[model samples]
Target chain A: MHEHQEPTPETFSTPVLSTTTATATAVAAEAAVPGAMLATPANESTTAQSLSTASQEPRQGEPTAQSNEIQLTDEQILTQMQAIKDEEANAHPLVDNSVDLTELEKEYENGSQAFKNKIKNLSDTHDRMRRSRGDGNCFYRAIAFAWFERVMLAKTKPELYTHAIKAMEESKDLLLAAEFEPLAFEDFYAVTLETLESVPTSTPEALLTAFQTDEISNSIVMHFRLVASAYLKTHQEDYAPFLEFGQTMDEYCSMHVEAMGRESEEMMLIALTKAMHIGIEVAYLSGNQSADEVNFLPFSPDTEPYMPPLVLLYRPGHYDILYRKSHCLEGVV
Target chain B: MAKPMFARRLSKELKDLAMNPPAGVDIIDANDFKVWKLGLAGAPGTLYEGEKFQLEFNFGPNYPLESPQVLFVGDNVPIHPHIYSNGHICLDVLYNHWSPVQTVASICLSLQSMLSSCTSKERPPDNANYIKTARANPKHTAWAFHDDTV
Candidate 1:
């Protein structure tokens, strides 16, 4: 992460740098531990954003002695910016280790009474929460991690693992049937399939590490997104009604479902869960005082063999993995 | 060392273009993946009939993921409402709306269609003013695609 960071003076007032890092750091510290947010390598991202703006700042007059080195082409700037985005994404672990559920409570300490009451009620059943990064891909990341972890812990029942591998293998056919080029999508499918295949021998830490890798984690999220997109495309009659007045199903899926960093809607949740036969229950947390207990939306596949649903906690725009006390596993760190 | 993703996608594109090229589009020079110049002949019935335009595509390391730098090159730049005299095209897919699924062939087809559908033969509204300040690379321009119909 340091290798990617530019050699900008930290003590100086760099507005572009400060503004971008603030949302990811200080404010996020209250919800998820301060240490985790502070650890994100964010310097390069700021410079990449404010390249044109940075040149306008007449701080201490004239240019610094290293002016010659700053000349870069638009292509160079865009590439560097892309690299910084990748590095920033890498800084935040995709799926963090489980933290006590009290972290959620701390976020709303100074807030509304409705939020307080809901948190108190949530404490009854859920023990811990694993945060996924809030990079708009949170919904996909959280669900993928939760399901992969569930597969890792199912040592006693090997068939669940077998079924998972089979489902992943067949997802390729889904992509092909949906007219996705094999050359374009095969690589993404391979990264996810190979990782899932190694799950029985893999540890929880190994799964987390794999998810942390920029290429591996994003590939899994992307492949799953394609799976969901393909499912939605093939079953247009079922989901097309949810689209806006004149928008077609393909337009909606291309803009929202298939694109990375596009926030997920309920339709995406249903399509992804139903396509993979992986049931999931999402607990919706809102500040509506009318509801005493947290609202849970369970997506169940219409089949006999779907595994017990993995849990996810949803606040306004983000998602994080939720663990119930009932989930029993032999070894977890 | 493994071949980079751009290399693989480009080779496949090169093969596809050779086997079945899009109508009125032919590659002039594709010696390497970094830059490829292709000829785009005006459609038979379009306003630009009998005119031949060259399209230059600059592929960065992030080819399919990031859009290629596409523009009309050579002396005969197209005179279309969306195309600037400087060869920078104001199209959504080439910029903000880029997706990985769109291949080189797809972009050529899009350019062909953009030319085919043209109802007028003229420069964009702010052509002279824009070309004076526009950077050599079209991607740097913060294009406001106010109109799609040309």
Candidate 2:
């Protein structure tokens, strides 16, 4: 959390000397976070400061330096501060496994009854919320984090890893059958397979660290997106009714499902979970009147004897990993 | 350390294209996986019949996630209403409509059909002005693909 905190002006002074070193340090700092990498420092203010300082040099006919300083209105300053805060939030890891649910309650203290009730319900079933960044990719990131964590915890059961690998490998055929070019999707699929296969050999600490790496994590998420897209395309007839705003299945998938960084919707979750043969329980915590008692909506319900269900906490526009007390001890006890 | 993912996918595509290429399409240069050159022949029974053109594809490190930079090059560029004199094509599939499922072969087939469906042979209306101010890469241009009736 300290790494995600906004860096003070003094912290910026040291890194400002070398742009290359600043970038390297930023990457390292992000890796230090729990699940995701730290966000890169915003270079806007630094650039603005340098330019202003350069322009402040006294000229023969120019007025005194006091007149050249720009003054920002209160509204402008507030907007700028809000923008910085948003950037800091975005830079936080895609998933934080130790976030307490009380923070969420605090966020809604001044809100309506629906929000308070939602939080109360969430607190009953979930003790902590593993936050995912609010970027459009939160759903994929959250799911991937859960999958990787499961693999690390279930290392003794090699069959789980093997099954995940088989599922990923089989997804290639689905994408190809859906008329996706093998060349376009093979790279993403291959990276996903590599990550899945490595889970058995790597230490749990190493596996966790790998997910924090942007290149590896993003590739895995991209592969999941492809799987979801292929599932929707193959079952277009079954899911077409859910398409909103008169968008054809192809148009919807192209615009939202297939495109990188696009958020997932209900149809996507259903199709993706069904395709992977894994069940997901999403506890919706929205402020809508309809949201009550942390409704646990199941995606792809399963009846397997040993299949561990993936649980997630869903707010209005974002998703986070969730852990139940009993399930968390299955690996150790 | 090495970019195995990009290299592997591009090589596989090159192999597939070589083994079975679509009609009138040929791979010109594929030694460098990051950049490729392709040759396309105008479809028969169309305005561009008997014409030939070359296309350049430059892929960034983030290759499938990001759309490739594609454009026509060489002297015999096609003259279509949606094509600029500078060899920029105004097709939606190449830009905003791009999906990760699309491959080099698919794009080539698309350009072939774009040529086949043309009723006339002419540059876009603002060809000269666009060519003058356009950046080196067509991907940078904010093209408005309003006219799909071409």
Candidate 3:
């Protein structure tokens, strides 16, 4: 048993200086080690400065090395690393539905021609983008927002709302069968039901505003994620082959698929789409696409022509809700 | 104030636990939903057979999303390799491996089994040193749980 010690007097006094130096060193180390900072830009200087101010004031301590060469305990280093991770995690909003597409175009102006073309393809289809926070829950958030919008649209149609509610209620058996304790997921399910219940009385604008509210939106997303996890677990045989590496189905879901803020992959999408009996069209705008073409991948494509599909726009690591003009009007009719 | 969702879920869990109390586990005090005190009877066939232990559970606003802070409390803390003198339990299910799907009942059973599997009656090797510096809340400590055999 390795006993963890309190920060010694020498290490306690200059936590700010020590943590700053440590962060800078860690960033420098990442840059030094090839394949460590690949694809991710090294935000060293900004991180160092932010970390210096963000560090808590040190407790009393004995005189130690000069501030420039302070030493940090393993615990202090871990805390600092967690703080940096938290800072990065909260860098974006839970859902920003008013992002301008031109901003994306401006970002890739000087980038590769292929990327530029992909941007043009995206611009042709989407007038704006809704940015989900990069906290690794983007897929769930995007789907939740889209689902709420659909519910709100179907409010005038009693049969549609009833069908959705029936689907939601039936999902409880699946979750229970998958060994999920009702105590752990009931509140999420309740909140989701409550949100759907409110749709009939609320205007679409009001519904949109409520969806933007963090607490309500996140709960709905969490509920969806849980349902998706249950679906994956119950139908493990269908998804096990898709698991990369040698990880077992339970391991994959617990670590990635079910865990909050763990980014979604193709397997999660497939499970969710199939479980909800909802068709999803993901418009992929990637640099790899043909010069003037975009790729639209259908997930759980609808066999019934009358069912309105849930569409999402996918760019490299993020997902956003997408609206097709005709589909939006169809709900009104 | 606790988040509405957390409070609601905890209430449901409290009701469920009341209806279906696990063997060898009793809810001692649950006046406050955020904090619960549970009494556990050592499972038969365990080294700690015939002993009773108290466990404290403190839930954050995140509740199911984040794991609750659980620690052994009271005078009769179990002396086992994974249980520290200060009452902090070194269980992976209480930490990194925690999932929202786990409930208080499941956790109690896991701890019960953990105690049942122990063969030694001695405290952890570094128990004295760790207790001296351990934080009031075990969640604050960065626990490195390497032993899983027990």
lDDT of 2 by residue, B1-150 (tens): 266556666777788899989888998887897789999998888887788899999886556665787999999889888888888878777766776677888889889988898888887777777776555666545555565668
CA shift of B63, model 3, Å: 1.1
lDDT of 3 by residue, A1-333 (tens): 433335232223323333224323432333311122112213322333333322221212213334344555556654765665455435544666555677667666555576577767767656666666544576898887777677667656777777677667867777888888777877778778888888788886676666666568767878888888888899888777766777677776766656565567766776677777778787765444345666677777223422476778765555667766566466631
Q: Indicate which candidate wins on TM-score.
A: 1
lDDT of 2 at A85: 34
Task: Name model 3 segments beyond 4 Å from true.
Answer: A1-93, A109-111, A154-159, A244-248, A285-292, A301-306, A329-333, B1-3, B122-134, B144-147
How far is B74's C-alpha from truth in model 2 (Å)? 2.9
TM-score of chain B of 1: 0.97
- Please report, as a residue range, the 10-residue window in candidate 3 chain A with the lowest summed lDDT: A32-41
Error of 1 at A196 (Å): 1.8
Tens digit of lDDT per residue, candidate 2, span A74-167? 3453355455434544456545545677876776656667667877877776667676654457789789878877876786687877777777
TM-score of chain B of 3: 0.94
Query: Taking chain A by itself, what TM-score does each prediction score?
Result: 0.75, 0.68, 0.70
As a whole number from 0 to 100, the lDDT of residue A153 in candidate 1 is: 86
Best by lDDT: 1
lDDT of 2 at B138: 63
Best-to-worst lDDT order: 1, 3, 2
- Candidates ranked, most accurate by TM-score first: 1, 3, 2
Model 2 ranges with Cα > 4 A deviation? A1-90, A94-97, A103-117, A156-159, A244-248, A290-292, A302-306, A329-333, B126-129, B144-149
